[model samples]
Target: MIIHGNRFTLRPDADAAQIEEALESLRNQGRVIPSVKSFVVGRDFGGEYEWGATFMIEDLQGYWEYLVHPAHRNTDQVGLPLVDKFASFDITDDPDPEMGAKIAALHQRRYDSDATLTQLVSDLGEYKGSAAPGAHGER
Candidate 1:
């Protein structure tokens, strides 16, 4: 298994809507990429970086596929401009006989049975569009 992690700070003028749009794009990318087993993104409070993302790929080939994917390329074009600074790393875990089963169980627990990446993107877009001022507290 390959784990890719990233931490980044968005530009001063970037707002939650822009952030969500980037996240939605990522989710959409994952949907089309078969190598992407699972992915997650989060916001860090009172931290040096504002956001982070983690991606789990099935193997090295999958990792390569993900890198060359058009959706992934779009992220570089559309998402990078909003970032102030960023750092990323990849970890290749040692092969374990039970890793596949563990990954399957973990994915099942983390994602809803009916949930699809498209739905997740849509939900994020909805939040971006309707979110009210101060709804998330100052900043």
Candidate 2:
């Protein structure tokens, strides 16, 4: 499995509403693309990029297909112009048991005294069992 994402900073004069409309259109277009397993776009609350999109693909070929799809291409034509700069990455699933253990131990320490955080970790742990690779906390 592969996770692909892009982060974009909107142009100073870019219209937020119009950009959202364009993103929605792109999302609609993405739904029909065979290569895309799932896709999501959202605004960052407080991050380096103002807007971002994330999607999962089955493999490298699927990733290539998604990149060349007319809908995706069109979205780039319309949306790229509204951005000041952008960065993208494609991540493939590569798990390290040691890292996973360390992460779990860290979470345990951080959340052990907090009810909300404990519950969140418990929920994610339960969900991870049934989720796909790279989904939830699955390694």
* CA lDDT, every model vs. true structure: 0.59, 0.59
True-structure lDDT of candidate 1: 0.59
TM-score of each prediction: 0.62, 0.62
lDDT of 1 by residue, 44-134 (tens): 5676677877788877567667766778767755676677666555566756665434433333332333244323323321111111112
Off by more than 4 A, model 2: 94-139
lDDT over C-alpha atoms for residue 128 of model 2: 28
Model 2 Cα lDDT, one tens digit per residue, 1-139: 7677767677778787869866875686569779999988888657777777888887656765675577865675567567665655556674643543433343344334445433433432122221112323343
* Backbone Cα, N, C clashes tallied per candidate: 0, 0
In terms of lDDT, the poorest run of 10 residues in model 2 is 124-133
Candidate whose TM-score is highest: 2
Model 1, residue 20: C-alpha shift (Å): 2.3
